[model samples]
Target: MAFVTIRDVAQKAGVSITAVSQILHGKGRFSNETKELVRRTVDELGYVPDSRAQGIRLAESKTVGLLVPDIRNPFFADLVSSMEKMLYEKGYSTLIGTSAEDVERQDAFITTLLGQRIDGAIVVPEGAESPGIRSIIDRDLPLVFVDRTVEGLDTVPSVVSDPYPGIESAVETLSQLGHRRVGFVSHSSLESVSVNEREVAFRAIAGRVLGEDGVAVVDCDNTFRSRKDALMELLSEGVSAILFAYSPDAIAIIGLLHDRNMDPGTDISVVSFDDIDAFRLMTPRVAIISQQTADMGRQGVEMLLSRIGAKRRRRAEHRRIPTVFVQRGSVGVAPPERRM
Candidate 1:
């Protein structure tokens, strides 16, 4: 089939080609009603904007890029969905890349997005630092970090949850339940924003309550089998309860416990960092520190748009979304001997 062009849309809308271009590009002054009319006409005509032509006109591909460490995880899935929805509403297409928790893959994805001349990007980095990220910043591409942040890159905007307090609360709850030997299960090293912040908070709180030797830290590869093995190891070390840095790890540990004929709440307490939908439906609902997934997405898009509209660099912005702890059945009192 022949490619539908701007002229086709203009003819259908009974407007000049310039008007159609302005409406489609979201440039210059155009009435909202007229914009809607042109959009409808374009849809009716099955018009697909020529991205090459768009690049020639605006020096941008009119595309936004998103990179996530793991798309299969529910938290990342929800985040990506929200971002895509918001960008779609603003008349921008999104290109998504899954880095699979690998720094090399993340770098490749960044290069590909930059090659495509994406207007902006939202990245959840697989590593704590990357030259690819630096390259984007050097080129002054509008960029935001979602869910994670790096240490040395101070100029980039970031949207993250304040994970320290929630970790502290979880540790305190476990300590109060008479759990002296408490353990933590984290996805990766204490370098990425979420994992590092939570681990720091957990260590501080656990040190204050249970002393240095009382805390056990286990690093897993953010996979079910790896997390299950880590949990089993912790359990063997007489850990009465475990704090999971994310929901996927918590769910995996719970499943492992069930496989061993142990009840989650009664046999071992669990606290998860992020709350997903399925957590509420479980027989023993999981306790969680919930991040505002939708809010993060909306805010990231708004920030990027603001930067794009300004057409100049503003002071670097770092916004932290608050987290809330929800008590559920997964937390219970420790056994008599394990009690503090």
Candidate 2:
């Protein structure tokens, strides 16, 4: 069967094609009776309005683009799922891109999204100083940042955890439990604002509480093997407790410690920043600094929608979300033998 078009609906409903277009686009003045007649005809005819045609007519795509550093990361995956769900309900579609922690890849994704004429975007930028992010900001597209904040660009709304207070609380908890030589495991380089904040906060807190001889900062290459090696090195150096930047790295360290016949709860204590589903099932539950992943995703979509609507009205706005710390079994008193 030939596809039903606006002309067919208009003819069947005894209305003009422009009337049908106006009704479908939710624009122009029309009587309620005429609008109801057009809508009923559309339903009966199974006529699906051509989105592309409508987009061309209005000069708007009615689509949003979402960019993340790594889709494989459970945190980003959950975030995407939440955003997509919210966008679907709001009559908008999403185009997703992954940067894989590379600036060039992020730049390419941004360029492609722009080329596709996406009305707005949500980006979890790779770094605060990334030139690609600056380029996107320069375009003045309706943009929001998730998970990380860029320093120079303050106008864009960002949803992120305040890492300092959380890190400080973790340090204080460990210290009160008699942990002296505490170590921190984080991804290499303080390029991303969230990472930088966590690192800076951890070091400052650890130094203030544990003193000069009590802190160790270890850079994890953000891989399983590298994280395992880093943990082994820390353990060898007599560090009894650690604050991990993320759950996956904490898992890697735990696995390595298990291989060395170290008991996570008794021999060493660990606290992770992000909670994954698997963390709850671990033998000793992992303590986590949890971000509201679903809320973040939902908020991102809401922000994008606001930007799209406001752009139509020539306006813009910014938004932010909060984070929380969840205590679990993984963090505990420091072993006397391992105390500095």
Candidate 3:
């Protein structure tokens, strides 16, 4: 099949080629509706601007780096897809890389992208302190953090979900349903802003609702075995409902429960912070605290491009999109005495 081009996009959108160019450059005098029409047309036609040609026109590399902590999780994969689509529409190529939550690889990926002379980067930070992140700032390369922010690196622009409201909602829902014992499961790393924020919120809200000992927390490091162990630990602690801090962890815990002839909605309630497609098809749909992941990805790319144009920002910009509570069948009222 022939490659789709800007002219084809313009023709389909009923706009001039110049309008398409100006819209892509974010300088079009066209109305917002016209621009959106062009965007939707570009998306439908799967048009990608030629990088070498656009590089010459813009005098830029026309390339950007997208560094993700891990792609195995649907959340990160969806995030990358959203950012990639937006950046592609804006006529930039993405150099995608994954660190698998390894700090060393995070630095290495940065060095590699820098050597490639990429114009900018959007990263999901692996941990709090990173020399590579600092170097990116020192070089003044356009950079933005998605989903998480490096600890103490408040000077860098970031797009993250404010999880407190969702956490509070979950706590209230569980409490009103007669859940007095709830467990929290998550990664041991707290350097990432989202994990730290969610954990703090859970402690403050769920802690108060359930009392001190009523709440159980199991923080594990890398490895599926560790995650499973954490979930098992929480179950052994006699939690009436389990709140998995991540979607992947919740899925894993469900598999473990099934293996032991346990049911999620009845044997013990389960809720996940992130939503997955499979959650809906389960025997009892899993409750979810849905983050504004698509918006986060879009804003990250927008901030990176804006920073790239400004060369340096006078003040670091930060945006925290709110999460939505999605009710499903994964939560139920606690039994009178509970059964282990």
Q: What is the TM-score ranking, best to worst?
A: 3, 1, 2
Off by over 4 Å in 3: 1-58
Which prediction has more favorable TM-score, 2 or 3?
3
Error of 2 at 121 (Å): 0.5
Per-residue alpha-carbon lDDT of model 3 for 170-227, expressed as tens digits? 8888888888889998665635668767777788888787788778888866567888
lDDT of each: 0.80, 0.77, 0.81
Minimum summed lDDT over a 10-residue window in model 1 is located at 51-60
How would the candidate models be sorted by lDDT, starting from the highest? 3, 1, 2
Q: Worst ten-residue run, lDDT, model 2?
A: 311-320
Clashes of 3: 0
- Enumerate residue pairs that collide in model 2: none
Clashing pairs in 3: none
User: How do the residues 1-340 of candidate 1 rate in per-residue lDDT, one tens digit apiece?
Assistant: 1235577788888888999988778887888888999999876755556545642325555689999988888888999999999999999999999988788889888877765667889998766677778767766778999888888787888898987667677778888788889998876642576676787778888899889878998888756668777977898788888888867778877888898887867888888877787788887998888888899889988888787677557988999988777878988999786665
Better of 1 and 3 by lDDT: 3
Model 2 error, position 93 (Å)? 0.9
User: Which has the higher TM-score value, candidate number 1 or candidate number 2?
Assistant: 1
Q: Lowest summed lDDT over 10 consecutive residues: which window, candidate 3?
A: 50-59
